[model samples]
Target: MHCSTPKTSASLDPALLRANFPIFGNHPDLIYFDNASTSQKPFVVLDEVCRYHTEQCANAGRAAYSWSTQLDRAIEDTRARVAKFIGANAEDLAFTSGATESLNMVALAWGLLNLQDGDEIMLCQRDHKSAVLPWYNLKDILATQGKTIHIKTFAIHEVGDYDLKSIKDQVSPRTRLLAMTHIHHVFGLDMEVAEIREIVGDRVLISLDASQSVGHIKVDVAALNVDFLSFSGHKMFATTGTGGLWVNPRVKDSLRPMKLGGKSEATPEAGGLNLKHKNTAELLEAGTQNIAGILSLGKAVDLIDSIGLDAIESHVSDLTVYLYGKLLNLPGIIFAPGMGICRCEAGFGIMSFRFEQISNLDLSFVLDEENIFVRSGDHCTYARDTSEEYIRVSMHLYNTKDEIDQLIAVLEGVVG
Candidate 1:
């Protein structure tokens, strides 16, 4: 282990930030490099969850008990925190299981309400299954209704960088909706969002799958001018069952609720009220809700803010660039073009490469034997043609320079 002294935070202290995460102290040897999949929770978030279950364990908007009231407050507080983090109004944010559920809610509900024959939904090939599958499923259903479901994709150049012109050209007057990720999960390339919005020019509604970009970087949905956005709490250091979806005020009334019943009505005028006709967020979310998970989400947001996203991003870029340089020099290692550490405009915490002589499964197994965990395969991007698979190592704030060195050491031994 390397000898180190704690640095005092002039802004948000990294050392103080480290103390807030129990996992960092408890598992000193564990190098968690798979942050793109899900981030480890900090102690503050864990305590929030523990405190909620132990003291405020009750349902919200129900019986008039003290615990229930506390639960309701906690849930609403999380909604506010999430909204502030992304620059959206709290009333526009809706809770769901995760990004997967949030996305499905939008696709199934919004697709049913607005989509018709000859309408188009454009997406990127690099989106995760959570963002891709729901809309694809809805497309199938729409086809049965005699509505044409046209799929248009924005292409990435051979170097893994996006060709913004391709997306600009793909948008037509008939395009009704566009759903895509804010960042490419496979390669960690940030999407051209503002440019895409300009090209669409209010002719179509834009939905962003912000699951990968929200916690890692700064996201302002209002400034970006997106109609819808979905992100998971687990990816941002909260519990897995918690996530939120943003529905812009413009199309709030148009959003439908695919699931309903149990604590969803504002005021039931009839015996069975209309679930799909409520106000913005309420119309989309209908359930008991994950009260504890939502509370933890607020804590996670606080933790990220205290540490500072800009500092974390800078450190991660440095680490990734260093790793890229070392890996590029190794024999039999296949390096994707335009991927070198972190460019100011392009890549971030995630980077993917492969070994020419070794299969992806074999490479991942060998790396795991050394306890250097890394992701392998297509990584759920359905649009990608599988001519070549990859091995992925995604870093986060908790990861250190030494850990990146260790990853290189193990890969060198395995490949050699």
Candidate 2:
């Protein structure tokens, strides 16, 4: 299917879009605001996933039977569709379990092979732990091999954006790679990666964790020019256990497969064994793929394409501003530092805040009682302090101002 260009509009109708999701019908009182965790699946995606499992169930790239071949072709088609969704080539994208595995693949498969003893890796304390911990794990593994790798820390500005000055000060000649988030999970602000690319120059490879940005905004890898980009499918309206890693053609050869089994070729030699692997995106895919989830991802991309990312972005941004304005009116409300004020012009549909007198956990329990779903905790960032937790309200196109109004009314009653 031909992907349609995203259309920009003044607004979208939330009540109409909400009809496409069955979850809303199943639970009439549910007001889902935790989009950063996982988006509710549209009927198109759910039906496609079910259809593939029941009617066209077969293993891809394994056999020449009609069902198997059909599945294989469908998988490749989905691969191209998903790659196009991010403005990347089909050969450059590889499927993984999720963003966590994708990040780990880069650390183990690429970092293990390319990083040297004196090389330094840059990371942000405010980014998700999945993006930060993999590199540290690489450091530990390299330590056992008698190699020293340094982890340089960067900062996030008071406004929740990347601290460009901090990055400039910390970047060095030995900095081999910089791992960062495209959009902050907790602060819900775009990290401005293009500026980061300018600071690091062309030498340092960049690995971006785009778990929060891809489906929510217009993400073009060609424009960002990052060496590696990773994201989870579930966060973007696809099924769980589905995600992708896009490698820049310049760095694709640098990655060595971490998992090896079926489909990987090896030959015996006099000295030992010689491993032969394709340098394309398939290099990282060693075992049988997630056939059902991947097919659903294609449908999700199609749905997004039909709705247009511009429309989704506009709708969600407006909802975020509305939510922020209402939250600000509530007395004793304290937004997460650096995210205290809503940047109407910038930022995705996410915000974190807490009440001065009410504990985050208590507030979450009260909100749950009201059937208002929200996330409250450290939000999986390395920099979070468990003692100072905040509640996260992440919006999507299906959400409405009426829901936000309800949330505000509940808070008003509690705080009153």
Candidate 3:
């Protein structure tokens, strides 16, 4: 199926695009608004995964057989394709399980090796726990080894973006790294990464969790100039357990492998075992990878490329504006901090809000009964002022204005 928008720059046909996904076919009335959590798989990605299992079921880089060689070539080709998709070199990207593992790798392999006593790492308090917890874990692990590392946190502005002033004020000579997100999972706003680089200067390493922005927006690693970038494929229409981590070659040598297995080379010496680990992106890939999932991720990249990020962004932006306008009309509705005031201008297609009288959990159950699926929780964030949960509605290219209208109608009924 041709998923691309018209050359005349017309809006995408969500109804037509929805045909490519089998989930909608199974549940025709289902309204999927929790796209930030994970997107429904397309037929192409599913078929690619099945093809790999059926045609050539062999381990990558294991043997000299035809199946192994074919699998090895496929994996390398996918590595190059996925790297190019994010404007990066193949040598700088490594396949991982997902964003969680990728972020953990940065903490264990890079942070553990490079950081010293009194070196501080900066993190955003409102970011996801996956991005925040790994560093704190590193701090605890280092303390046992007698190295005292300090963790500093910065706050976000009312517009759901990083507080540039807060970041600037916190940077010190001992600040080694700043871990942040590309697009906030709950706020849906782009964190303005380029501005962040200017504030922290050239000395501080920036590690970005691009879980929400990789397939949703145009991400150029060179332009962002971050030391490390991580994202999950499941959130981008690929299977779970497939993701990529891109490391800048300048900092490649600073990362020590956290895990070593079959592929890593070592030789016996008179003194000890001499470990030979390549200083490229493949240094961390020590075990057999998720071969089928990685192939599906490559297909996901192909599908996204055919559709074009510009068109996808435009379609989702229009949906966000429509959804935000309708939600504003709700009688006792309250948006998350900085969300209502932004007026759907800064972010991608994500919104979190709640009603004055209705409990967010109750509303989620009600919506689920109505076949409208939304996420209701703290969204796995680290720092929140209230324990109250909010209803999150995230959209994608396959979502339609009609679906948003149905959600608003249901919400209005509950309010009335």
Candidate 4:
């Protein structure tokens, strides 16, 4: 199918962009379509991480040495870069191991403070395990304290897109928090957060899990008016073991740090040591951070900025639309009529589908045989689907129209 939309080529040539990623050079024939799981890192990002580890490896925010100072500076620089990427202040962003840890920090912190008997926490059914399990664990903890954690779900219609009307009706005065993923990992659908805020207003605190959205597209916390946002670097072509949380400055004081450690201790000189801490990003960061990973994350964000999010968004939209069209023509391919289409104010490079004639795992194995990599199963979503019948194809900036054509040809040979 021809893309009728006018194509706007990126400033960075597709070949040069592909060359930046080391994985492509290593396996030139590999068609990686599982970016939603984790993105392949560019040479710049890999070098940044390697440089920190090999030349200037030291702990951050502690001690008084040149290496330590360098480490501290790099970490701070990364924080600033991440903050700018999401249109937030550096003070509002806290480094975590990854999106899972970031989500847990806020969910557990808020759950400890606000949850009580008969309080409900609103969650959408489309959430990933990283976004959903944190709250479920908190619910268990709250239950032991004579609090029965109530759950209210926002339904995804039969077509797999989120139904905003369900969210509007689920939110109530007793709702303590509303946890939602900005992008649905399985279907690649996005939510209208502004509409959500309009429907629920400030009556409920909103936490946005941008694990699949953040790096693939632009995220503006101020514009979205969300209380919290979580994202991971690995999903954005950076090294693993790096992610962050953006907390609204207004609620900074209210959120108690769940992971307190060396950096978390402000006053160690006083007779007995103080646990009460200043409400800043440091409070949530806790220990000596992942210096190398953080720097690599910053480099990845810089690379994205250099390429431009507008170009990335347009590239992915067209690629997914093309792939969706091709998949529809293939026999046994099952996807929503609006499968490749996204309703996000901003979209990403992702699409998901199912197969009626073959098992998803078997289909994935067949694709693997052809040197194609795609993700199958619920994609780390335990509550969403138990069967491994769902298949997802997630692309990135390095991907091109030819790659989609290759994927379609391979699938046609295998499944058709």
Rank candidates, lDDT, best first.
Answer: 3, 2, 4, 1
Instruction: List TM-scores for all candidates, in order.
Output: 0.90, 0.95, 0.95, 0.92
**Who wins the lDDT comparison?**
3
Model 1 lDDT per residue over 122-176, tens place: 8866668887778789889988888877878776666665567877888888898
Against the unseen true structure, what C-alpha lDDT does each candidate score? 0.76, 0.86, 0.87, 0.78
Q: Report clashes for each candidate as comma-separated counts.
A: 3, 0, 0, 0
Clashing pairs in 4: none
How well is each residue in 1-416 modelled by candidate 3, as lDDT tens digits?
01122233446778988999999999999999999999999999999989988987889888999889889899999999999999999988989999999999999989998899999999987898899999999999999999999999998776566778888888999999999999888887777788888888889999999999899888899998999999999999999998989999889988787787888765669987676766555588988899999999999999999888878888887788778888998998888754565664534788888888788889999999999999998889853554435899999989999999999989988996
What are the per-model C-alpha RMSD values against the true structure?
4.7, 3.5, 3.5, 3.3
Q: Write the per-residue lDDT of candidate 2 for residues 1-416, one digit (tens) a residue.
A: 00122246656788998898999999999999999999999999899889988898878878988998888889899999999999999988999999999999999989998889999999987788899999999999999998999999987666667778888999999999999988788888777788889999999999999998888888999999899999999988899999999999998877778887777765669986576766556688878888899999999999888888888988887777778778878899887743455344544788898887888889999999999999998888864575446899999889999999999999999996
Question: Which residue ranges in model 2 land beyond 4 Å of their true spot?
Answer: 1-7, 268-275, 342-344, 384-388
**Range of the 10 consecutive residues with the lowest summed lDDT in candidate 2:** 1-10
Worst 10 residues of 1 by lDDT: 1-10
